[model samples]
Structures are given as structure tokens and as C-alpha cells.
Target: MTLKSIHIEDTDLQIEVKEVRKVSKIRYALKKLIYVPDADLKPKIITKILTHIRNIIENKVKEREEKDHEIGIFIAYKGKFIKGMVIAEDNPHYSSRNRRAASFGWLYAKDYEVCKELMEACESFARKRGKKLLRGPINFPKSVGGYGLQVEGFDEQLIYGVAFNDPKTAPSLKEFLEDLNYKQDSEYLSMEVTQDRWKSGTQLDKDIKIRYLTFEELNNRKDEILDILRGAFYSVLPDAFGMERYKEIMDLLRNIPSHYYKLPKKIKLENDSVQTEFVEAWKKCYDREVITFFHLAFDKNTDNLVGIITCLPDLYELWKDNPITRVNVDVAAVRKGYGRKGIFSSLNNIGQLTGNMLGITYYEGTSIWNLNEDAIRTILPHGRINRRFYVFQKRIKNPT
Candidate 1:
């Protein structure tokens, strides 16, 4: 049983750190924040961040206990006009946040000053404990949930299964984190997905055929697609190396539900052992029939599945009118030899046309940080780019 406490000046704010699981009331209170009435969520728009808070406390605590890390931090805030709270744990082995690749996710804070104070305490605690780096606003580990802050797109709100934050909060985060020599990192880029890309005449020749994947075929052929995904991504992306690291990758392929979410880190290794399980899980999580996948294969000469794309229809409505889903084309890939052939241009053209026919009014894309540069180029002729977000990273110890 270990604990600690702290206080701020001239305010009711006090922070406490202690260990206790199964806090039921707080969990219920948190649920309220998750679905706060949109009307009450006016002005500051501080909609109850209960979902994030609940994750930090309950699920994350279980993960820490499993990892056997002995230190945890908790804080409660009572400010002049706002009340907030946070919880974090010091456990590097905690693996469920995204897929366990994330070795650090600790120190939760709510408001500006308290967040700053909590980060300071975290830095001091980590320094005293002799840890290498401070890595998260992690919920527990990679498999669970962990998304830090968005330094780039301040105007964009988060989507389902993602974090939503205030723009002002990001600048403060930059100062606090950078001052501590902590680096910034991002997952994927959201590019303007337009319909005009088909102008490249990149579609497969009449000889090459485009086929929709049947559920049975999609199920049976998961391993092959997974293998290509692994091989194509591995050498280029060093972050996704081992099977455990690919757990999230597999999970993503299995459960994207048409509203895609990027992996915590890019996939840098080549191994597709878990693709079957991943796709199966995805099917269970999503029941929207309009969502579909198209896997492009070269002619009968070879059994190669070179070009691929996932298309979602009516996603704009699914997101409750959130513009992020206006029309999303994701997980697009094309093999090396197959490049320059119009495979990707063809896929984007047909995919967007299909989406438009299905009632999707807008088109969008979230590009992984290290994916094919050509795939992006192929989309240029089709649609207009609605947004462009940058990804940045700085190693903590390599500050120069």
C-alpha cells in the first residue's frame, strides 16, 4: 500500500495518489460524462471526459497490477471555476493500451495548471526511479487505449474510439512536454480524399478484373492478405516487429467497423500470423452492412493480391454528422511491381464512385505515417484534399 498527496495555492485543488480498485460510484458518475447532454456541453464544451477518466482508473489499474509495476499516481482537482481529476500508473510492461508496444503511459491530469503540475511530478518520479523516458497519457498498455495529445490539427475534433481535446490544451501540452524534453509523436495523417483522382486512368486494364470479396472468401483468405500486409509493411516500418506488436495490427484488420482507427505505432515488421483472428474480431464489433472491402488481384498469371482498399458508405451519417467520416478510404495497399499500373488510381476511382452511389456525400482518408507515397499520389486526380495533418516525433534523451 503506497500513497502520496499534493496541493495548489489559493484553490480547493488537492491531488491524491493511492491504490484502490472497484470504485463503483465513480464509474457510474463517469458514464454520465460519456453521454452528457449536448446542450449542457455548451461554451467551454468540456463535455464530461468520463470515458477517458474511467479508462485511466479502472481498466488501466488492472493492467498495471498485471504488469507488476509498483508505483501509481492519482490526482483530484477543485479549481476556481472548473473541477477535474486524473489517474496514472508507472508500469512499462503494461500491454493492453493499444497492443503493448507502448512501454509508457502514465501521469493523468485534467486542467492546465494541474496537468502541468502532474507532469512535473511525473518527471521527478520517473527521474528518481531511474526510468529511461516518460511515454504516455496511456490508459494502461497498447492493447487497451492510449492517445496522447494532438499538436497539429487543433480545429479537428476526435472521432469515435479516439480522443477529443481543446485547442488551447495542446499549446500548453507542447510547452510542458517540450520543456521537460519530452518529444511529440503522432499516428496517421488525415488527407483530403477526393473523387477527382480517377483522371490518372490508373484503373486496371480490361484484362485485369476487380472483384468484391465475399464474406467466405474474405474469411478464408485473411492469412494471405495478412501476409502481404506484413511483408509490405515490415521493412519500411521498424516499429511493428514482433507478433505481440502486431496484435493491434491484426485487431485493426479484424475490427475497423468501417470507421478506421490507426495503430498506435506504424507497422514496421513483416509477419501476418494473426490476421485471421483480427478480421474475425472486427466482424463481431461492426454490424453495419453497408461497410465492405475490395481486394484487387492481378490476372490469372499470378496469385498475388497486390492492390487493396476498404470502402465505407453512409459513414458520415454513422458518425452522427461528424465530418471526419464524410467518406473514408483506408488500409489501401499496392505491391511494388504492380506500381505505375493504375491499380491504386482504379481502386480510388471505383471506391469513391461506389461510395457516392451509396449516398456518401464527402470523401476523406487517414494516411499512416509511413505508407506508400505513390498511393497518395494516385488519389490526386480523383478528389479534393479536405485536410492535411502532420506527424512529429522527438526522442526524449536525444534532445539536441
Candidate 2:
């Protein structure tokens, strides 16, 4: 294990930062501490930690193989794992506006002093890389672990794939970052609505046709689906989603263990007269069973996919014997020119109907940026805000 020690001024404690490369070492080190509060869930939590570490390694390998960019991970330890972070030059070649930044997550510190030391370590690491700014707990990439810190609505249940910090630990971390002059760089909200509430009065224009796809269908037409996904978020988040990044995302999705969860056995359409092309496509591409839900909107005249919304069972919630009744809406996007044609509304209407038919009671919407007025307006009538998360950023003093 490679270690570096930095003395905490005016105190006897010294912070030790280590670069961990082996999954076995991480597992052995983590075994010494109780990372999760629930005894029943500790094993699963450890699996998740190991999985994240493996992903970081895989990401680095991909970067090297593709000759894309450079990235690194650091873990701060004082007898045990206190905090960990990842730093990267985020797709510098892809966009001129891309900032040199670090993504920090899996932060677990007991007190402000340790937290302060961890933040300083992160800043120093970024400075050494000639980074101009630092922004995180983004966990390497925003698509994998999400962005920002949860500052409000801690009483709510956790959403799948979204980062969760202990309520008590959250305040101290926030205060320490503020003390160090970090400011809120961005904010997102998570909202929730029952299937009944969302399905009551929602309607779509007659010209729009709603279609559903299974995991097999999605995998078969991966390129087309990826194009739609890219086009939808291109204007809003150009820097993040490229062809390479999209491939990484699809790889992660395909590796999920679908056999453990219960998926809908059949598609029960509310209207049988609706075009059967999507269903026929699914039949042709049907392969294995995977728990995934996709609702796509197409123009009846042009037969072009205009919008899409996807949901997956909350795996953590399902593991806890929660009946797997709630599905988290992971992505919702519409083509630029088709935004006002009720494409989004049509997708939502189908989403609710499908959820209800599958015995899903709740639908969770996350990563809803405050600047997205159209999305906010579309969901406001159906759901209420459950929680808010923020991303903090600070300018580095020196570039080199």
C-alpha cells in the first residue's frame, strides 16, 4: 500500500492518504469498519463498494485503451477508511468549456476535522493536476453515481442509484465545505408521485403514438436508442454524453443481474387498436428476461421517435423486502423540435399506465435540474418535490 502522511496543524492527528488499486485490499480494509448501519444490508453495501472500486479501475482502463483522458482515485485513511475521492480531467478534448475538476464521493468522516483534511487532500490533488476548479461528490461521472450533495429533505427514503449521506454527517460536511469557501455550483430535485395520481387526468394529443420496448428490443436497436438519448440531452448536457460515454452506460446496464428481480410478464395495452409495430419489433428481438421499462413516443405521420422515458425497479428497496413496487424514472427526454407536441406528456401517460398494470404504486423522478422549466411544469401536476441535492465548487488558487 502506498501512503502519504500530512500533519494536521495544531493537532496531534495526522491524515494518511493511500492509493488503492486492488479490490481485495479495499474489501479487507472496509471489513474493519461498519460502513452501513443495517446489519442485514452490510454485505450488500460492501458488494456495492467493491463494485464501485472495480468500475473506477475499468474506467481508467477504458481511458488508457481509447487514449481518451487521465483519471485517478485516492482514499484517505486514519486507521480506517475515512474518506475517498476521484479526480479526472473531464473530457477536455470534447468541449472547450469543460472545467478541470475532481469528483468526490463515498465520503465517510466522523467529524469536521477529518472532513476538512479530506477536502484539502482533494484540492491538493486537483492542484497537482493543474486543475482550475473542484466540483463534486459526483463520483467520477454524473451518469453513474449522480451529482451533488443532499442538503434538504433528509427524512425521505433513498432513491436507487442516487448517493445517500447520513443526515448527521451531511450537515457537518456542508458546514466544513462552506467554511473552506466552497459555493453551490448546481442543484437538482427529486420528486415522487403515486400511479393513481399521475394517471387520473393525463392526456396526449391524437397525433402522437406511444410505444413500449423491452430490454431485448432496446439491446437490438442500441444505436437508434443511443441516438435518441444523445439528441435529447445534447443541448442541455453536451459535455457529458458522447458516443464513448453512452457505450459505457450501456455496458453497465447490460451487466445488471435481471434474474433476481420480477419483471412484467407481458404487455397489457390499454388500447388494442394502437399500432403494433413496436410489439412486433419486441417479438423479433426477444431474447432473455431483464427488468427494464421504456416508453417511447412517435409521430403517427412521420413514424419518428420523438421522446422517451425509462424506469427500473429500485434494487436496494427490493432487496429490503419492500415488494419492488416503486420504479425510479431514470431518464426522460424529448427531441428538440418535438418538445411542444405533447411527446413528454404522452410518455408520462404511458409510464403511469404501465406502472399501474405491473402493480407498481410509486414512481420516483430524480436528477430534475431547476433550469428545466418544461420538465418541472410537466411533472408538477402529478407529483410533489421530495428532496433537493446540490453540487459544490471552488476555484483553485494556482493552475500549476
Candidate 3:
């Protein structure tokens, strides 16, 4: 791919945008050495940044080879690399109109002025590609991209699976995007629930049975699981992945080895009762060290899948203690007819119970859209709001 370069007069910064086919190890090391300050925050902070950077490079290369999607990386430099962003063209399964988006992350800059120029370059690059609308801080897809900007709740530590930038940079980036006419497209709220607050109230109808997917079942019935996910989120997230892309993503996730996860061994309750049942459930479902948990609700009368909740071990925290202390609730969806039947609440109750049994202290749930009042209500009872993230978009004046 060709490298595109431009100069911003306002900041006197030279900007370059290019497709990242290969990232040199030396350059990667240099970035780590230069950008990371030698301070108390260096070790944990640097590791987080480096891990994300590596993922971006690898995904960009794979995107290029597939040729089904378009992705590019942009960098701002005066004498050296100051800012960077990633842009991609997304084809949602349900949307008829073509869409393009960009994610600005691993964002480290000297000042806000440089950040502004970097963002402008990203917008220009997207427009040149004939994109009508642009949305992000999202990497490649909503599932993997860690969507949104941290608009509120700055006092807390960053959680796993959620996107975050340097406290210094995040506020300025938000200000720049707002000033540049990027309107708020969407908002997601993050919240946490304590094990004590996770009380079970109403139960599902007698006909409805809650079931956990075994490792063998996950492999044999992967397609059904994907279908349930796509159907559940189709209305709420119209821009969800298409069938082909959905399968591709699942395949990638399924291939993850066991060692990457820290499995739950034993869970004890406040009553001093040992929860061996929870440990046995986990053992039955987890064939490897993968940290994903899936719970499905089935309607016996129709013998159909009605609801699903997916959770994964908070990788950031897991790696630190080598234990499943926290979990990130990735997605929770109920089929149309299944709504208002307490399926959503039941699934969460099960999640909390399972997590508690495994010694998990907290559960992190995100991407709860502002318009989703029902979901917000369901979560509010069990979790406290920790952070809010926003997606901004602007329409291009003229398409190619």
C-alpha cells in the first residue's frame, strides 16, 4: 500500500497515513522506550499500551490479506511519531448504506494541538475513501474494538475489556472531537454489581430452563450460538456483524488456547458453604484455559433458545493475579418473545452466582446503550455506574 503524507500548518506537524502490513520489532521497541516515561506507572502502563499496539498491527495485516475490509493507520510527526489512529470500512449485516469508521487509540501526544491535527488527518483519509459517515475510537469491530470515549467517571481505575487512554489525553481528545462537529452517535455506560446486591427475585416460567454450554457443546453447536447472538442483538445493534464476518470472528475466538486464561478453582460463600457445584459446572464447560462463559435459556415447550449471556475473564486483572477475580460481561441478549419474562435477570443472577462461587469479586458490564432503558434498568439494580463512553459521528459532505 502507498504511504500518504500531509503537513498541518497550524501545528507545523508532518502527518503520514499508511496501511500497516508489517510492524518492525525495532520500531515497536523504540516506541515503547520513547513514549513510556520511566516512572512508577511505567511497567503496568507500558504493558497495556504495547499489548494493544501489537493487536492492532496483527489485525491490520489480517484485514489486508482478507481484502474483505479496508483498514489503515495514521501517524503525526514533527520530528518523530507523536499521534496515531486506525480507520476501517465496516459493512454491517443489517445496514443497507455503506459505512466507514475510525478508531483513535494508543493515542499519546505532546499536546492537544497535535492531537487535533492527527484527528483531522484521520477524517480526511476516511472521506477520501468515499465514506459517508464516520464513527469511533472503535478499532475494527464493536465486538473487538473496545468502543467509546471516556466522557465521565475518571476517578476509577481502567477495567479490562474497556477502552481507556492516558487521563491527560482522553479529555483533550473528547474536546477536539466535539469542536470538530462530530455529533454524539451513541453512548454506552459501564457499571459494576457486588455479590450481595446480586439477589434473585422472580424466576423464569417452569417451561423455561437455564442451561450452561459444555466445552463439547460449544464446539459442536457453535453455529447455533452465533445465530442466537446475531438474532438477539439485531434490533438493538443494527450494525452487528453479518453472517460471514460473525463466523470469522467466532473461529478466531474458538482457537484461543487454554493457557491464556486463569480458571476458577473453588468458590466459598459468606455462609461458609463450599460451592463445589459451581466449580463442577465450570469444569464441565471449560475444556481449556479459555475464560469465556456462556449461559443459555431454553423454552421446553417450543424447545428453542430464548436468551443468552456471555462473559469472559477480565484479562487485564487475570494476568496480574493469575486468578479469575473479575469478569467482563460482553453481551446479554434475549429473543423477542422472551422479553419481560425475567430471562435477562435470571441470566445475570446465574452469572453472579457462578462468579461468586469461583471467587470472583466483581463483574464489569459495558456497551449498555443509553436508549436501552430496559437493559439499563436491569443492570442498575445489581451494578453501579463506573464509566460512560460515547461514539461520535459526522456525515461527509460529498461522497466520491
Candidate 4:
């Protein structure tokens, strides 16, 4: 890209546009560094992911061209064209799952001021692009670019597609844009698995029978297992419950090597409205057994499923080679009024017992804002700490 113009004033700086393909080269380089040798990301796979990014940019460019709008990203500091962003039009469908994610690209900057200038340039370009809203630090949603801004925490390594920036970056960016009439848009929170405040309990072992579904039993009860999952987490993570999305998740889950461990085969819901597509999908994505480890709490008088704990093992490997196996407690629920009745306590005891049998010395459970801490405390006898992730936003209109 070629430089467009630069006007430096006493306090404010005016940046000109530029023509440079540095963004492409940077993305290509990052991919090469992170490629796992035996991983599924072969040449074709790499190309496809890159193609997705290209298509988004091309689509935005086409829209600007046809609409007679000016859509161009400017380099705030030409010395290094390090950051990039995709200008979007608007979000027509804003539901949690079907949100119309327009701008789905990454934005990086050396400092807060430079990022601010670039944001302005993008906004100016957006006006010509016929856009009515502005937001990011994200290229897309978490499923895509790991959406939002970094506010609370800055000193942490970012996940594959997640975004991170200096602590001052979000506040500075927010203030700058606010002064320019940008309104506060939204707030998001990122949490972590901590080990500070939790108090361990043995109730799980005392109350519930916890066991890995023996290879044979799991195979025969696939449908029932998924039903339990559907019933267990449908209320918490609603997105994963959608028929189509659930199928995708299930396909991913089925691919786990643990499926061969007599893990349950996913059962298809008999109702026409409830399809069995998630079964195959689970096989594609998950690398471990279906319902790697599960717990069922029962009343001494009645043998009914009252409380359950479902763990996903993909994250468990993060602590591979170490004695402790960090498992993401994907689903842990107890019927209302039963929470304090030692259901979770029993589940936790069973999980730890099963972990011990499998040679796993430790366990890690991920958490976020507004999650029930008491139940978690019942499981984690040890204390917990706080870890922060980015929560960013931009404005759709100038503030009053």
C-alpha cells in the first residue's frame, strides 16, 4: 500500500492512507510458527482458513465499491504497518447465535495512540462504507476471531484466536472514542480456572456413585447420555443446544480417541424435530470418549438422575505429563433445592475418585462471571484466584 497523507497538528495527529500488503505477510508468518507437525492443519487446511479471512475482506471491499462508499484502512504510523482491521456495516440480527457479525478481522497496534488513530481512520472509512456501527479489537465472534476488547488484564498469553492488549489500551481507546462522541456499547468478561478460595469436600464420594461408563455400557446408551447432556447444560450455554450447532459440537466430540474406550455412542432423539446429526459431528471434533467421565447423584430411596457432572478432556491434556489432569467441568447441574443437599459435593468426590483411578493427580475447572461459586467450592476444597480476559466494545452512534 502507498501512503495517502499525514497532517500533524499541535495536539492531534492526522494520518494518511497507505497501500501495503504487510498484513498478508504477517498473517502468513504467524500461521507458519504455530503449525503443529502431525496436526490436521495440512497445506489444504491452512489454505482454507486463510481463504476464510480473505473472503471477509473481499466481501467488505465489494460492498464499499458498489455503494460508492470509501472503505480503506489507514496505517496510523507508517513506520510499521503492524495492525489491521475490517470495517463492518451493521448487525441486523443480534441474537447470541445468529448475530450478523460484519467486521471479522484482527487489529493490532504498538501503542494506544496509534491504535486510536487507526480506529478513527477506520471509522472515517466506515462512513463512506455505509457502516452504522463500530466495535472491536476483534475480527469476529469467539467462534471466529475471538471478539471484544482487552480491559482488565494485559499480562497474559493469548489463545489461538483470542485478542489481548495493554491494560491502558482499552481505557485510552474508550476515552478517546468517547471524546469523539462514541457511546459505551457493551461489556463482556473473561474468567479463568483459579485455585485459591475453593474448599474441598468428600461429600461426592459419600453421596453419589461416580464411574467412567464402562466401554460397553457407554456404547449402548449413547442417546441417553446425550439427553443427559442436553438436559444438564441447555440452560447455561444455550448456543450449543441449537439442533444444528449441537450436531456440530457432537461431531467434534465423536472424533475423540476416548470414543473407543466403551464411551457412549450418541443416541438420536426420536422426535423428528430432534435430529441425530450431533452424533456424527461429535465424532469429528472431540478427540476423547463421549462423556469422558460422568457422575449421577441419586436419592437413597429413588434411583433417579438428580445431579450430574460432565467433563470434557480436550483441555485436560493441557497438563499432560504432569500428575494432575486439568479437566473442563463442561456441565455440572443439580435440580433446584438440591444444590445444597450435597449433590455437587457427591459429584466432585466422584470426579476426584475417578481422576485418582486414572492416575490424574489434580483437576482444573474453568469459570466466568456470574457462575455459582458455592457449588464449585464444594468440589474444589482448595482455594481459587482470579484471572481476567478482554472485554471490549465500540460505538454505533456518537454519544449525546
Best by lDDT: 2
TM-score against truth, every candidate? 0.59, 0.77, 0.74, 0.50
Residue-wise C-alpha lDDT for candidate 1, range 201-316, written one tens digit per residue: 44355445454554455656666665555534222531222332233334434544533332212332223422232233233323333224453555446655776775433222
lDDT of 2 by residue, 203-229 (tens): 455676765555566667667666676
lDDT of each: 0.43, 0.60, 0.57, 0.41
Q: Candidate 4: TM-score?
A: 0.50
On a 0 to 100 scale, what is the lDDT of residue 380 in model 1? 47
State the lDDT at 247 in candidate 3: 50
How well is each residue in 1-400 modelled by candidate 3, as lDDT tens digits?
Answer: 3355566777676665444444453245325432322233335554544444555445543544344344445454455653554444433332312233333444444455555665665666567756666666663334333567777776765454565545566777778777878887788888876544343424566667776654565657666666677655434462344454445435434644454333444433323332333334456445554334576778878767788887766555543555557667877788777776767777776667666655668777876777776677667777688888887777766535
Q: Which candidate is the best by TM-score?
A: 2
Compute the lDDT for candidate 3: 0.57
Task: State in Å the error of residue 130, model 2.
Answer: 5.0
Residue pairs with backbone overlap in model 2: none
- Return the candidate ranking by lDDT, descending: 2, 3, 1, 4
Candidate 4 structure quality by residue, lDDT tens digits, 66-181: 23322233433434333333333233222222332223234544444555555666665445445555544443223223345555545533332233444544566556555655
Order candidates by TM-score, high to low: 2, 3, 1, 4
Model 1's TM-score against the true structure: 0.59
